[model samples]
Target: MSEPDVSKVLRLFKEEVKVINVGLEYFYKELRKQGVNAAHVIWQPKPELEKDLEDILKKIL
Candidate 1:
């Protein structure tokens, strides 16, 4: 049998994400679609994901 994908367990949980400010409005919508919250701390954004986050924030907010 093929090895199981252990990576899934290390991934983010759906409710783990926290939404705030003007973004909370649609936060739940996206979270439900992805099957995981993806969000973590509501403070500073991760440097690696900064670029993508900025793009999304600019478009949405």
Candidate 2:
């Protein structure tokens, strides 16, 4: 496939691009402080027997 236009991608960055922070709440907060549209997904280790979280991660990945 052909490469995407870098200029177009850079133009999008000039606008508000919503960010989904999978971890590190502080990083999300810092983005907001800079007037960025950001959201956080609180992540933590679940019990070893838990499979639901792993399934969700698979879908996202």
Candidate 3:
């Protein structure tokens, strides 16, 4: 729509925006530089869980 939704816009302007950046330090830094709340989580797959096994686990779980 051309015009913004009033309530949504008001909440955005009034509330603090939060962001969780996983596996990307750049995005977290940029978000902080822009003054938004940000948390960076470093993540990696388990060493024993190979790609094929991981895929099967995803299907089963």
Candidate 4:
């Protein structure tokens, strides 16, 4: 295997990066106010029993 292309990754980051704010509405609003492309998702804590499964699903989905 070989090292990845850092220049290509940097170019893509500069051109097409986006921010996803999963919990805080204020942070998302602030980012948008700064002219950034951002999105917000309302997130809530699951019940204690469901927390473990929800964490796994969060990673997979």
Candidate 5:
């Protein structure tokens, strides 16, 4: 494998970093602490899935 062009890597490094933090708020907090643009999105299991798998989950739990 060959190394990437240095100029391209440098341009990417200069660009602003934006993140979509899904599921976990911890990652978003860490990113904010580092002066990164971070957005948080709530993630959870779909209600339909819970309804469909309730029987199996009950048995397992």
Candidate 6:
């Protein structure tokens, strides 16, 4: 709820995704240790952000 907790949760999500991509079990474990909840932190698509992200992806591709 607080700023630092929100930041930590966000950071953990990124680390978890990286772990998942490389199949790093320990990193995933560490993310859980930091009290990151996947349901809470994993991004959900919003209309505006989703559009922006799609644009960015198109550019990258």
Q: Score each candidate by Cα lDDT.
A: 0.59, 0.85, 0.88, 0.86, 0.86, 0.58
Quote each prediction's TM-score.
0.21, 0.52, 0.51, 0.54, 0.54, 0.26
* lDDT order of candidates, top first: 3, 4, 5, 2, 1, 6
Poorest 10 consecutive residues of model 1 by lDDT? 14-23
**What shift in Å separates residue 57 of candidate 1 from its native position after superposition?**
40
Write candidate 6's Cα lDDT for 19-50 as tens digits. Answer: 23134556556767776543223444555657
Q: Could you list the CA RMSD of all candidates, in the order they appear?
A: 13.1, 7.0, 5.4, 6.7, 7.7, 12.9
- Give stretches of model 6 more than 4 Å off: 1-22, 39-61
Q: After superposition, how far is residue 21 of candidate 5 from its true place, in Å?
A: 0.4
Error of 3 at 44 (Å): 1.3
lDDT of 3 by residue, 1-61 (tens): 5976599878878888888999879988999999988899998875787789999999999
Clashes of each: 1, 0, 0, 0, 0, 0
Q: State the lDDT at 39 in candidate 6.
A: 28
Q: Which ten residues in a row have the lowest lDDT in candidate 4?
A: 46-55
Which candidate achieves the best lDDT against the true structure? 3
Query: Residues 1-61, candidate 1, lDDT per residue (tens digit)?
Result: 9999867556746336544333353665676567754543345554675788889988998
What's the distance in Å from true for residue 45, model 6?
29
Please provide, for model 5 over 1-61, each residue's C-alpha lDDT reduced to its tens digit, 9 standing for 90 to 100. 9977799779879998788999888998999999998899989877675565898888899
Model 4, position 15, has a per-residue lDDT of 94
Give the TM-score (vs. native) of candidate 6.
0.26
